[model samples]
Target: MNDEVTRYIDGAAPWQTAVCEKLRLMVHETVPEVEEQLQYGKPHFLQNGDHAAVIAVARNKVSFMVFNATEIPVVKGFVRALGKGDRKCVDIAEGQEVDYAALADILRKTTIAP
Candidate 1:
């Protein structure tokens, strides 16, 4: 984890922090060689130096974004947000329960090691 990313996560709300941490762990588990840094005010995860995902924390929710997403995963208990191009993000509300298993599956299929 980059210092900037740590600071970003540490400064987030408790719920957001927890979700971000979970996302971070899942990202690493899915792609062991993934590199992390703060980009565009979010925690960016790179696989083989390619943009893979980003974790964003907002006032009301925390979002996990998958870049170059071809088919967005249908995750239970999440609000899907689509951005420009192939980027897709799933937002978890403040008191929402995340489906870590499903998220891990999605990341497993999405993240590329090289």
Candidate 2:
């Protein structure tokens, strides 16, 4: 885990901080070799030097994105498709109940070596 990434999460609002922490934990648990860094003011997870996932916080929501998500199924809480549909994001609000297991599965699938 990167210290900058930890600081980024620590600086967020309470709800956003919880969401960021959970997402970060999920990424690391799902991909043991994942590398973490603070990039573009957000926590980015990389696998073999390629973007695997990202955790970003906004005023009202926390967004978790899975890169290379073209094969990822549209699960609950996914609010948008990005980067020509190769990335999928789930936006969590203050009281939202996210299925972290499912999100972790997505991360595992998307980040694993072919």
Candidate 3:
């Protein structure tokens, strides 16, 4: 993890920090080849030198943005962000239990090299 990214996450609220860490750990644990870095002032995960995912902390929730995630996964306890694009996000609010296993599966599929 980059120092800047670490600081960015550490500066968030406690609930956001916890959710951010969960997604960060999921990326590293499930896709060891992915690189961690700061992009557009947020922590981004890269795979094959392409943007794979991003961690965005908001006032009410932390967003796990999955790039090229055209197909939504059936992850429990995760709500898809409302938007349009080849991207989608799972908004995790305070006290929400993160389903790491399901998130790992989604990460694997979304980050796979075509």
Candidate with top TM-score is 2
lDDT of 1 by residue, 11-90 (tens): 99888888888888888888788999998888999987889888988889888888766666544556364754366678
lDDT of 3 by residue, 1-114 (tens): 788889999999987888888789888988898898998989999988898889999899888888777776534556464456467678888888778797787777787844
Order of quality (lDDT): 2, 3, 1
Q: Which of the two, 1 or 2, has more lDDT?
A: 2
What are the lDDT scores of the predictions, listed in order? 0.80, 0.86, 0.81
Report the number of the highest-lDDT candidate: 2
Candidate 3 global CA lDDT score: 0.81
Pairs clashing within candidate 1? none
Looking at model 2, how many pairs of residues clash?
0
lDDT for position 58 in model 2: 89
lDDT for residue 31 in candidate 2, whole number 0-100: 89
- Worst ten in a row by lDDT for model 1: 76-85
Which 10 successive residues of model 2 have the least lDDT summed? 72-81
State every prediction's TM-score relative to the real structure.
Answer: 0.86, 0.93, 0.86
